[model samples]
Target: MVRSLKNPKNAKRKSKGSKKEDGSSSSNSVPSMPAKVWQPGVDALEEGEELQCDPSAYNSLHAFHIGWPCLSFDVVRDSLGLVRTEFPHTIYCVTGTQANNAPNSIGIFKISNISGKRRELVPTKTSNADTDMESDSSDSDEDELDNEGPKAPVFQVRKVFHEGCVNRIRAMTQKPHICATWGDTGHVQIWDFASHLNALAEAESNISKDASTVSNQTPLVKFTGHKDEGYAIDWSALVPGRLVSGDCKNCIHLWEPSSDSTWNVDSKPFVGHTGSVEDLQWSPTEPYVFASCSVDKTIAIWDTRLGKSPAASIKAHSTDVNVISWNRLASCMLASGSDDGTFSIRDLRLLKEGDSVVAHFEYHKHPITSIEWSPHEASTLAVSSSDNQLTIWDLSLERDEEEEAEFKAKTQEEVHAPTDLPPQLLFVHQGQKDLKELHWHTQIPGMLISTAGDGFNILMPSNIETNLPPANATA
Candidate 1:
């Protein structure tokens, strides 16, 4: 069974003001979120709510919710290079079934675009005779979501269909309607929503009596080369169909689309790491360059043309390196997370043949699972941990001389004082366990979404506009 929810009260709240220069709003007020009526761990829905029935007997119970991390910031350009204060009104969530079931799937959800203008719900008359009519009305609304962009803030589960259990799923920047996923199946699949999203939308909306019909399961493209199920996959930003994927077998493969609609793969996998290549990323500006982190506690940079050796390598962590993120704006800067529960930032220009880490973050108490650089700001980054928490870090904040002096007086930790202190932890998202991955919304600067064992969470810091300065203001 599947469930959907919406609170009319939340949709009617007005946006405070225009975005500020620094990407935050001048108004400091954070609109309060609706009270969570569904208690944690409860899978049942309230009365009057319709239950979506499916013969597959998939587990639909999960604790999914949203949160506010901060009140505000100034405005900045989005990943699309557009300056906007709002995010899209949809989310793609990868969901899984119970331990005994193999009902893995991805859900398309329509959510309130709370980052901008207040979107209100249309008032409807309630009548017992209108029960079936209401269901049809809901279907019609979903069809509109597929045909047109969001016109109002409507919270609903648009679709849920089976896809195998994928470890990572990423929507493309160049093509938002296309997404790529990889996992234990040793296959990297590319899905094109343009070919089927509208079809699914039309099928569901046209349902007069049946709502459980399954949609097509075919993917646009599939690539197989890894010795094991891939753990990481990324599409290049500068090049359209160029992609890279790594797996538990310590092998990395580069993929390109051929003229025949088939995938051309690197015959020889990029090899160097002694352990599983846990994560990989393509350089935003460099078409031929990419980076990968491994369980071997090392991070390596490779050029597609020269697969014989890494362009650069580092002993990044004391324990297994789980993930690494390239600074989108700062080409030479990168951040890495490890099983030791530490976050380190390094400048490739300054890294010599030594174990010199420029900065460290120690807030997470367990292994870090994911790390990402904010698309809007060069100095801002986000990370998730096995400790069931998501944290946002801003490197722009600097420690004063007094704090530096106090730290030196307190402990003689090293011969030389650390060059930089830990970045400021801007937000901490709790109440979830074993978070697997987290990502910043490309269109919305401050909004983020995360996936965990319990379910998925869409989080936005309160007063996200306050993070930026006014358009007329100078920073």
Candidate 2:
């Protein structure tokens, strides 16, 4: 569930003279300070200026860099309890990198004690060490002066060599120890990282970060079935070990879990989209149902039990539909982000060809790199973009004309938006360059982890209004 207003700070903009939406106001007028909210896709920086994050917007923010930028990564569900609301969070993440000249690798990281001095106000790694962006944690933090026993945060990496650069990486939800990767060499590989997981947990590893000679680099199964490199891949949530992969050639393959710890990938491919499939999401509730978005500007719903054709399809956007997130909590709700930086929410029950759009917003100026629904909230979703911003939105919100008038009078903002910026837009996170993908931790209520050109960020937004008390709140 979302709060009445996304940013609690925004409520301060209202004057005591102005009536609340429910017609309540203070008996005595108390003027407030100017309300300053950055409008992305609309605001531009002047000369000698740069964007800075309002640190109060975050609960706990920590950033770490892998030597090379990872194009994709997945948070491994930890046994640290499924509903973590406490601080000093620990998480395991698996990622594959796309390096320049260096050999690519898959790193399983144990990032722990991800807590720092809470900032009353802060921004990028540039503004202060205690800020929004990353790099406080590295592969080897030996030389940093922290004689006081892990003061900031620490990351332990067990990296195994990979053949080619990984285009995408995903850990199977049912079996987190087993993972799959899509490589630029038109190869799809499945790996069992039980030993790697053990080594990371034990703070010991034999696998060198760049050595391919180690037996651990070998994948349990590799299929060169796809004609070209692809980014669309997903493990089924309904069925353990079941997987689905879609490629640039518009061919999708199904992997049935075999008893021998191997996969039986069908030789025949599922064909539906005319362009490259950009992303895939299995139905959180139904094992056989899944969804795919493509460069063809459409989203397709497929059932593994049905034939190659999609069970249903929608012309989703004007440009390529870069990503689609199927809401796990609200099964009928689906959200999509496009290459054009516009994102929309849809109610799948209105799956007809004409219109199913429940909400739409064009706030980002570049292609949407990744989009995901909050596993904990049915109406909330997050989107990352090439515009270098990640935005959180709650579809349950609507623009309050009176609230805006008060805010506008205090801030002196213009009358119209770039066609009325959806009030549902809650928070905007910046400071990552060449941003690629982001994911919310299913085990942690409000925690999020994202990968970009700079590295990775693990932050919980203070303003997003989660069910848990503030991280600093005492028991």
Tell me, by lDDT, which candidate is best: 2
Candidate 1 Cα outliers beyond 4 Å, as residue runs: 1-81, 86-100, 113-163, 199-213, 353-356, 399-423, 463-475
Candidate 1 accuracy as TM-score? 0.66
Q: Candidate 1 on 1-475: residue-level lDDT in tens?
A: 0001100000111224433212345464544222222211222544333222110111011124322111011111113323335343343332222222444444433344322222112213344344233222122121333334333333433233435555566666666556677744677777765533443334422334233333556777777667787667787889877888888888888888787655788868889888898888898778999989988889998987875568888888889988889988888888999987888998877867475466788777688878888877887888988766677788877767786566555543332322432437655556555566777765554667666655565555432322443442211
Q: Model 2, 1-475: lDDT tens per residue?
A: 0000001111112333443323345465654223345554566544433333344456666677877888899999767676776667778999988875777789888877766333322222333333213323221222253554345566777778888889899999878989999988899999989987877677633334543332347899999989998999999888899999988898999999999888899999989899998899999888899999999999999987888889999999999998889999899998888888888989898876568998888778788888899987888899988877888888888878887677667645453333455678877677777778999998777777888887788777765655553443221
RMSD of 2: 9.8
Once superposed on the true structure, which residue ranges of model 2 sit more than 4 Å away at CA?
A: 1-41, 48-50, 116-150, 204-216, 401-420, 468-475
What's the residue-level lDDT of 217 in candidate 1?
60
